[model samples]
Target chain A: MELLMAVSIGVLTACGIYLMLRARTFPVVMGLMMLGYAVNLFLFSMGRLATEAPAVIGRAETHADPLPQALVLTAIVIGFAMTAYVVILIIRGRKTLEHDYVDDRVNERDHGVAEQGLSKRAVAMPETPASAEADGEPRP
Target chain B: MSSHLLILPVLLPLLAGAVLLLFSGARLAWKRPINLAACVALLVVAVLLLLRATEGGAQVYVLGDWVAPFGIVLVLDRLSALMLVITAVLAIPVTLAMSAGTDRTGQNFHGLLQFQLMGLNGAFLTGDLFNLFVFFEILLIASYALLVFGGGRARVAASMHYVILNLFGSALFIIAVGLLYGVTGTLNMADMAVRIAALPAEDVALVRAAGLLLLVVFALKAALLPLGMWLPAAYASAAAPIAALFAIMSKVGLYAIFRVHGLLFGDMAGPLAGLGQSLVWWLALATMLLGILGVLGARDLRTLLAWQVIVSVGTLLAGWSLGTPEAWTAALFYMVHSTWMTAALFLIAGVVVARRGEARDSFMVDARIASPVVGLAFLAGAVALAGIPPLSGFVGKALLLQAAGFSGDMTIFWVLMLCSGLAGLLAFSRAGTSLFWRGPVAEVAAEQPPMPLMPALLLLVLSVLLVAGGGPILDYLAATADAMLQPADMIRAVLGDRYLPGGA
Candidate 1:
């Protein structure tokens, strides 16, 4: 049981780290999500890998350690919140930064509304912002 | 004071944040005053807490009547109370300055600020390792929002890096906590200390890894060298008030190091004692050098101040590395001094950024801002921050250097610290010249200033107060340091009877 748990954790963590190193924000977010999953599993297994035992006391001769269960629950809540936040952050970044890459190496492929989990082109550029109105058009 | 007032620091801002959120649709005038009122009450509570802490011994508040090692606890010592005071101090000015106009540029600024304080206070006050992680997330999430509060392309870009880096740190933080709970069988920090102090020889390696992982998370927060690249751009790009409040954020990490690391790996831990000392020492030196280079290379004032944050962290860590009573005292003293100094400078930078027009706080601006009031305040801040004579900065450095003298190998610290000061002097003079001399005097004026400089100048005046009251303050800090060195007593206080009476 311990070996199985450890192997799965290793695989998830390895995949997460690999994806995290990618240049685009989408992969990075996915990597973080993967890491979050691996961590939840690791935390769950920290209670020493018992089977079918209830966390409730006095119901059975043997009981599971309930602490890690609680810890995992808390971590899951926080992880869910952080994932929601980071997704929104990426979507916002896509609109503003106009590229999906973590660092600056923008090219032709990144120029439009964000789709496929990458940003559309930036909404406006400081030097040459695109607008519906012509140049020198005054506010109504 | 009632022992229950311990909960107030965490609860007050939480309630305030909730109130602010409920009133989110309100106009700026109403939001501003309400936030300011909450901040003032928090400051008062912080001062009372600090005073109570100065009376000595760690105060532990058990939540839901759960015994220690079983449920959540809020622990306040001199160190934590001081941190709360510093946060409250920075919050008010940051809020005040933001009220001048910047808050309107962002939605939910008032709510975010209050939540950020709640998180900061909670982190300072938490006794459980898991609770500490929760507080760190709260603060980090709020800061992520506040960082991009004013919404610029640069702000979003910089905040993206900040958010991603912190999210990674949070992941590591939990992994460390899991490992710790696995080995120690408890999440309450004092209990963990007791367990680790008498840890079996075989488990030492695992505990050591957990300890170091915890250090990495805190170090990342503290912006120690390699982890700090995101910090400069992120801090530089934020709206001025948010950046100003952020001056205290790195110190939060250092605070955790002193609180959590010192508990887990101090003189008590048998095999793992002094685990992170050498690594911390060398990194601090490297961090100082990097800071000096960053300061010199920075073309903009805000980034220069951000690098100065790194330098201050290095200095604080250098003091902490010794683990001596005197060194602890000096680190605390220097922590308070530098946090205020940095916040003051950021505020000043905000004003300068506004006054510089299109040049926007770059050292190469071609205009002179002719406010005598601002110039004098700038002079005071620069002189003190550079560790020149007769102010808090000089006294802080001298005290830390004095503490280092007894620790042996004081030579490298002395050399690095002096060079950092020299670096400060050189860089600030150049910035000063460009700001005060090179610009065309008084040829341009903007609309009403974006933020007030009074709060910044008042914080600079706080430097003078630190010096005048240094003796009593240092005495309290020395006692606080002594208390910190004896983790056994704190464990007893927190654990009450659940702790084994005798150990290390």
Candidate 2:
């Protein structure tokens, strides 16, 4: 069960990172939601693996670690609130800027916004001429 | 019964806020109740906490029957209570001065502010790491709303930067907590302190690394040097009262640094002893240099004051890094003093902005409407901030220098002092020339200022009183300083390890 949870977290993290790098505000928002899921699971798994166990004491067996479970519960609630807030903020930003793309306007203005979360490999290298032409950019 | 005072400090404002929320539509009526309750309750709490800290060493109040790591505990030690009291003392007047004349905001404003206070107090008093993070989020979320309460383009843009930075810090904090819990299997600060101390020499580095990661997050929150570019822009653009409230925020980070370094992870004899030397002290030196340059280069009064706050962070870090008992006292003393002084400075800038109706590039824009009282208040704040003798700032800096010692190797201390002195002269001289010496704004129609002179006068008087009473304050601080440096006191308090060998 712990391994499954860990695997799920890794999957969520990869998807989150991928979507977070997208140019639109919507994808970035979705990416944050995915990252929140991963964080929640990661936080929950820190107490180590316990299988076939309830969080409460029972006649047949002992309970799982109640502390981590409790922490995970709080994180879930806080995460939901944060996601709601970010969604609203994105909507507001879109309305104010009159654009749906996160990379528009503010990113162009701030300059650092685009560079903030990029992969080092992507940042270090410009696209090759064939790739640039394929992507419909100037080869030179 | 006295222990009950602890609950009241948190509960009173909370109750007041809830009541205010019910009257959200009442407009003008909401202001008086919120102002009065916030003022009285905070004053009472601040005084009571100080008195209790002086009389009884440190008291822990368990929320219910559960003990140890299971139940929540509110620990009221000298350091915790001192921070709480200072927060309250500054919070009340600033709140009153802010809400006095402004158009009524949403009734939720009072509730959010009080809730933020609750979170701050909780963060300081909490005995568990998870609880600390929980309260941090509470304060942060509420601060987000408060910072952008009355919407402006500048406010939103600046607040975006603020939120993103703090959110990143919070994420890092959570990750660090998860890693620490993985290793130790405990979240209680006291229990973790004991376990970490008992670890084998080889295993200690992981814990120290965890400590450093956590420190990095706090450093971000505290706006240390290079990490502080977000501060001046965000703070200078916010509403004055909100900016004033934020003066308390960085202290929470500093408080965490104090607690973790002095109590929980305080194996100063281990590999971590040099950690402060390389990380905190050097960072502090850089912070001072950058802060001075920023203050000098800043184009507006609000941003200039904001940059000064960054400078104060440097001062506090330098003092804390000294690690001597005397050094701790100086750092702690400077912490409280800077909070009030910065709040007052921001308030004065707000007043200046209101009168001129424009953000002036320098302090020297208009003079006729500048009230004598306001100028006097700014002068007092400037004098205190500059470390001029007979003011509170002088005492704080003097103690810091004494603590660091005047040995030739103390170049950091000397440079910081020299910069502060020069900055002090620059700040006051500019204000004097621009505010008092310059001609009045004869063209614009005059409007009566919203703030009652009473509150600003009260703050000025308090700043002066602190200056006069520095001798006794110094003595009291010295004792607390000694308590902080003595590893045995902290270990026993946190770990209950009296029977363990080498525990002392």
Candidate 3:
């Protein structure tokens, strides 16, 4: 069981890195998601792979260690919110810059569209939940 | 009751952030006072904490009265208190500058500022490794929005790189924490230190790998070379004050290395003593050498300041890698000097951006604001940043060189430190000539209100104080370094009398 878990994490991490290295925002976001999954699983398995064991300490002779479970939950929540944010940001990028490429140097034109956006102070906030998206601060 | 002071640095900002978020749509007249008031209160709290930290032992605030090693904890010592005070000082000017109405460029400027403060304060105070990760995310999220708040194409591209790289870093941080927990069976740093002091032979390799990963995570945060490619563009693109506030962010990474590595792998650790020191020493030199080269290559004032930040990190890391109390003191002193002065430079750069209509601090001599005040402030910041004589930078670098003089390989450290200083001098000289001397003269009639210049001047005042008080300051930092190098009382303070070795 431990072998299976470790190998799965390794594979997920490998895939995540590969995707993250791609040149587009979409793949990068996907890569972050994959990396998040890998980390979550790795954190969960830190307590070791236990079956039919209660998480509550002192519940049984061979109960599972519960700290890693709590850590994993927090990581998952933060990761999910972060992914949602990256999606909003890239959408805005796509609209304004007209390209989804990660590195703007590869295919960007004059940055005038955004500088026009910058020239005014009271420019309306973009139509994203960024103002409300401080992410959940899970105090586990 | 006094111990409660430890938690206020984290809590004041969290509460204030929530309140400011509620008023995000209100008139600036309403939000400005609130932001300034909160920042002043935080500065007071930070000062009190620093005063208390100077008394002796680490002040441990057990959250919810949970026993040590069993729940989250906030621990304030000399090092963390210094961090809190530096952050609070930086926050004041940043808040003051933001209040000048540059904040209208975004929707919740004050709230994001407060949240970023909370994250920095919390990261400094938290004793548990995982809690640090939480604080890092809070800060990163706030920084992300703040970086992209003003909405520029250059900024979005920069934010894209910054966000993705940080997300990757977050994953690595979690993996390291998980692995550390798996090996040591604890998360509290003091307890982990106790455990690592007596770690069994079989688990040594795993702990070493975990420790190095933790180091890498921090190095990435500190912008140690190879891991820091995202910094220059991201920082240079962000609105000026935001980039200025971020000066301390890299220090947080350096701080973690100081706190964690010094505690967990100090000389007392049975077999793992000095685990990452050699690697840090070598890479830090390389980081410094390359960072100076970066300064030479920068085409704009903001990018030059960004690369200078990388250079400061390298110098500080060199001091830290020395593994001596003297070196730590020097590093701390240099850190205090550099963080404030760098932010002052950025704030001044913001002034330049506002005043120079079309050139926008691009280093080309197209147009110039001939305000003597701007030129004076730029000279002060430049002189201080480049380690010129009679400034705080020179004193700080002297202390570092003095400390490094005692190390085994002083030759390379000395050469690199001197070369970095010379590089800074040349870059700032070129930037200065182009900015002040070569640019075409312009009418000063349409000058923007000097409100933003207020904060930059204030930061310069702080830098001057650093030079005037260098003697006493180094003495105090020496004591702080003493506590970090020897963590017995810190551990005892956190674990109470029930502390045990190799026992849960």
Best by DockQ: 3
Worst lDDT run of 10 residues, candidate 1 chain B, spans B441-450
Runs of candidate 3 with Cα error greater than 4 angstroms are A57-61, A108-140, B406-408, B443-451, B498-504
Tens digits of per-residue lDDT for model 3 on B160-252?
988888889999999999999998889999999998988899999999999999999999999998898889998899888889999998999
Q: Model 3 chain B, poorest ten-residue lDDT window?
A: B442-451
lDDT string, candidate 3, A1-90, tens digits: 888888998999999999999988999899899999999999999898889889986777889998999999999999998999899999
**Model 2: lDDT of residue B113:** 77
Q: What is the lDDT of residue B314 in candidate 1?
A: 92
lDDT (10s digit) by residue, model 1, range B113-133: 999999999999999999999
lDDT comparison, 1 vs 3, better candidate? 3
Model 1 reproduced share of reference interface contacts: 0.72
Better of 1 and 2 by DockQ: 1
Ranking by DockQ: 3, 1, 2
Compute the lDDT of residue B449 as modeled in candidate 1. 49
Q: Which stretches of candidate 1 lie over 4 Å from their true place?
A: A105-140, B406-408, B442-449, B497-504
Give the C-alpha miss distance for residue B475 in model 3, angstroms. Answer: 1.6
What is residue B47's positional error in candidate 2, in angstroms?
1.4
Candidate closest to the true structure, highest TM-score: 1
Model 1 CA lDDT for position B251: 94
Model 3 chain A weakest 10-residue run by lDDT: A131-140
Candidate DockQ scores, in order: 0.55, 0.25, 0.60
